[model samples]
Target: MANRIHPTAVIGDGVELGDNNDIGPYAVIVGPTVIGSDNWIGPHCVIGTPASDRGAPHPAAWHDAPVGDPEQDGFGVRIGDGNRIREFFSVHQGTKRPTTIGSNGYFLRSAHVAHDCRIGDGVTLGSNVVVGGHSEVWSLANLGLGVVVHQHSRIGPGAMVGMGAAVTREVPPFTISRGVPARVTGMNVVGLSRRGVSPEAIAELEPYVIQGAGELPELPAELAKLLTEWAREGHRGEH
Candidate 1:
């Protein structure tokens, strides 16, 4: 199927789009940004703008528009398939590398992903959520409304962050985090159970979430991979 792009939308140069995308009115997708299939980009959403740094250059995104220099265009954004990006969301261009968003994501209104952020598959970011630059939100993680993730932080796979929390540090996998400076309060048992994780495995992962230092109990291959990554990243200031 063909893409449905509103005439009022601005698709700048070097922007590549796959099939079946729905781009709404007044949305701006600038150059160097690559978007995959089946994406719903809502009104007023912006993607692949310049990095947030004050000194960064704004490269020309349009085709031969002669507005800005394309030679200095540092890096752009790469978005995967089946994403539902709601109104007023913004994804900034990367400073060092491409700011990447994985497949099957749902970002609510007024959310923001700063430069160099990495978002994994099946993630849901609620309204007004903001993630600082270089942060990573792993697969299946759910962030509630108005959650603010600090720079260089990681929210591990299947983690759940409650609304209005300010995450100053990393969040471990399969955990529930909330409050001002978010800390792991409990396991994400509901999420785990919904994903069909066995009770034994969920119980075993509890210590890993709580203590943040221990041998991981036997889990499914994917869960094990996520845990290993969490360990390697080292729950930086999880408390």
Candidate 2:
């Protein structure tokens, strides 16, 4: 199949696009950008472009840093296959490194992934969600609308960040976090089950649900026994 770029779109020099990508009307894509196959870029979305550096010399601002020389090198955006970036969603290329979006991820309308953010596969960011620069969202994690993830924090695999939550610390795997400071409500049982987690693993994980600790304490004795049994029984690959 041939590449189809809308006549109103502005595709910059050195940009690389794979087959069957639909570039929306008036959307701008600047290079050093590489977009993979079957991705949908919605109308008026600006990609692979640096945010305008408008702040004064704060000594810590990206525009004032010493690494600013060779400006565009090592800085741009790379998106994998089958991702959908919706209308008006602004995804900026990195200032110091590449902004990487994994395959099968969905960015809803008005969602913003700031520079240098790493989003893993099958993740979904709801409308108006913001991911700070340098933050890592692991595979299959879902962030509800208006969630704010601080830079440098890690959101673990299969985690769910509730709407309006502010995450400052690491969100553990298979859990749901909500509220202002983001407390864990419970295990992400539905998410785990949908991914085919074994009944034994769920049973194994059930007894150690201690509060204040987001996940099970590092393989406690009872949980470990079940895990060992599950592994020995050849059912360790579901989740």
Candidate 3:
């Protein structure tokens, strides 16, 4: 299972490619980078560029780390197995630390994963999505096309961010977001069903809850407590 690097690709020193990877034409991979098995890096994608050189750091840049690392090469990107990174997507290596993407994530065309981000498994980033640095997108989260995640916010496991949404704060698990500022519309009903979440559980959660972001404060303490319990359970249940 050797890697397939396109003739036009520029693979720099310290770059490690795993088995069966496809490096598309004109893709640039600056090193100290480690890409896992079955990765599809599409055409014109830039991987592991030195910091400072990437130009003015975005405001969400600190979301990756505290910043101010003397050497840009000190930052690196670590991608797990089975990821499909589409054309024109850019995944920046970490600054002061390593940016990590878990297994089974899909990045559609033009999606951006900034420095120091920690993405969990089974995540899907739609076209033109932008994930700010140092952000944490938990497992099973689906970000819609053109969604913009602010720096340092945590996307809870199983969250669904709708297209064109601007997410400034954390999105709790099993919630669906859509709006200018991205309000939670409801639970991810379809997602839950697909995953085989029992109907009784969904029914119980739907009633004791307020559906939107603003209403989180209004949810009953008992429900809030239960949410915490459920999250703990999920953590323990992960494979």
Best by lDDT: 1
lDDT per residue as tens, model 3, 150-230: 988777767899999998877767778898788878888888777666666666555333332222222334435435644
Ranked by TM-score, the better of candidates 2 and 3 is 3
Tell me how far the alpha carbon of residue 171 in candidate 2 is from the true structure, in angstroms, after superposition: 0.8
Per-residue CA lDDT of candidate 1, range 1-239, in tens? 99999999999877889999999999999867889999999999999887789887766565443233334644678999999999999999887778999999999999999999999999999999999999999998999999999999888899999999999887888889999999778999898888778888788778767675456877777777877776776662235
| Rank order (by lDDT, best first) | 1, 3, 2
Between candidates 1 and 3, the TM-score winner: 1
Candidate 2: list runs displaced more than 4 Å.
51-72, 203-239
Model 2 Cα lDDT, one tens digit per residue, 180-219: 8887777788876776666666555544332222333344
Give the per-residue Cα lDDT of candidate 3 at 172: 69
- The local distance difference test score of model 2 is 0.73
Q: Which ten residues in a row have the lowest lDDT in candidate 2?
A: 56-65
Ranking by TM-score: 1, 3, 2
Which should have the higher lDDT, number 1 or number 2? 1
Off by over 4 Å in 1: 60-74, 232-239
Worst 10 residues of 1 by lDDT: 62-71
